[model samples]
Target: MTTLRLSVLDQTPVGEDHTPDQALRASVDLARAAEDLGYTRYWAAEHHGSPGFASSAPEILAGALLAHTSRMRIGTGGVLLPRYEPAKVAEVFGVLASLYPGRVDLGIGRAGGPARDFPRRLADLRALLGEGGAVPHAPVPPQMWLLGAGRESARLAGLVGTEFAFGHFFSPVGGREAFEDYRERFRNATGRPAGGALAVRVVTADSAGRAEELARGLLLWRARKDLGEDAPLPSYETTRRHRWTGAELARAEVHRTALVSGAPEQVHAALTALAASHGVDELIVNTLTADPADRRRSYELLADAFALPPGGPETTVAHAARVPASVPAGR
Candidate 1:
């Protein structure tokens, strides 16, 4: 049996009636909670022009997470490499890696620009990070990762010799093929073992009905966002206020397929099976709930179900005095 590892993928969602500042703080608190619960990693996500998300710069957010927690790796889940110069990215994460040492990850993504030259840019990035002693120095190079949802991206990651993280939460289909292609091509080209993780959205509660209820806000948010009605995630009360149109109802059902929600044991079984099918030992979970408390509870339940050992007795960053004011806030 593959020894399953659980991690977190935080989008830093702006939940109901919360400001972007609040959303970012929630992410910090959640990261500390995850570390205490023994999640292996806590990766911040990047989003642009999205009212529902506050994490536009994951590198900055990752730094804050690193300072706030003593253990658990922190990373950008990822940085869209196409938008910025490779040298600049290397400089930023190089600083992070130096500061945090072994606990930083630089997850690269191809969110924009043409795909043809992506591999070249990735190579350029590695070189800048001291891949073959080509250039700039990094005292401790952060672990490199390629985040993608398709076969081509998987193949590119393999050819470039970086760990691959499949975006099962972004694009649920074709995961098995992507994983297989990455491993085979990586082993053949680099003559080294390949590593990968699958990111999936999940919601767990004490009861199945409660889990579904907690997930309702996100479902509504997704349905509306699909129709270009982007807005902050609504509260469950607010979600109940809206009258669902036939079109919206149908759309919600489609989005529903992307989620795995239930009581603790049920969600654990589903995630274990899902990871097995994708040939990955790690599953990065992305959960969104209208209320921050509910979101925290969801992770707490999952921690118990997975039987993860606690990292230590550390309180959340909520105790402002615990974290130095000099520590920058997560963006």
Candidate 2:
């Protein structure tokens, strides 16, 4: 048992049959669920100009989730830094930290910042979140994470003195070296010492075949999405019916290669290995199943496998077992 902490990275996916409102609501519901399941944190993503996603403004959603749940840390899987000024971002998180104290996290991703300005923005952020800024009574400041994927980003994270969350789902090869670099170069001279995590795309089910089926199909849906298709996630039946073209199948493999999917034991072993090999304190899971129930179950099963601590209000949910009748095997 690796004792690896687990967190969530929710995109608030809007399926073909569901509305954006429903997707946002589901994010809240999942955050609450994550708290109960004993996950370490629940981080919502910030995506804009995407018809398939509902989490455009993660701070607002993060605040909502923090209000809705108790104990589990809540944050943006990353607040895109390019869209807003660093001081404003600092103030917003400062207020949130004042309200929730230790339960709030202000994770940053290199969204809008060009390479040269990244360090300056981080410096400004550090100053704004310092004792001189807003929240005086904040017992502890919001946890600052440098969400990165490559060598440069990792180096910047170490230089800026923030924890790192390597984006393994994006570029595995790049992220591996980046994680190593962060661990080697990290300097925790000032505030909280730097720790690191790896975020990966994961899928699991009752059986290995079912899990692979789900993983493969979900990859295809993502591929279609990257190609600018507004198609809703295909149902299991539809996935079964659609013949896979060579090109599409190859594209699907790109996603599938990074995905960890299988039965409970297999998934557990995979995650444990990943955590150990990467030397990360946590594994932030990004689940993208087509069915809401399956997605929820994946987290539940992982929590159980790790014997993670459960928190939050609703400890028992009968609704957990119910899967909508409409869902097919698709992603």
Which candidate tops TM-score?
Answer: 1
What pairs collide in candidate 1? Answer: none
Taking the candidates one at a time, how many backbone clashes does each contain? Answer: 0, 6
How many clashing residue pairs, candidate 2?
Answer: 6
- Against the correct fold, how does model 2 do in TM-score? 0.88
| Backbone clash total, candidate 1 | 0
| lDDT of candidate 2 over 51-106, digit per residue (tens) | 77888999999999989987888888889887788778877887777788677777
lDDT of 1 by residue, 225-327 (tens): 9988999999988987888888788888997888999999899989998988888888999999877888899999998998877872232211111111121
TM-score of each: 0.91, 0.88
lDDT of each: 0.82, 0.76
Q: Model 1: residues >4 Å from true position, as ranges? A: 132-136, 312-331
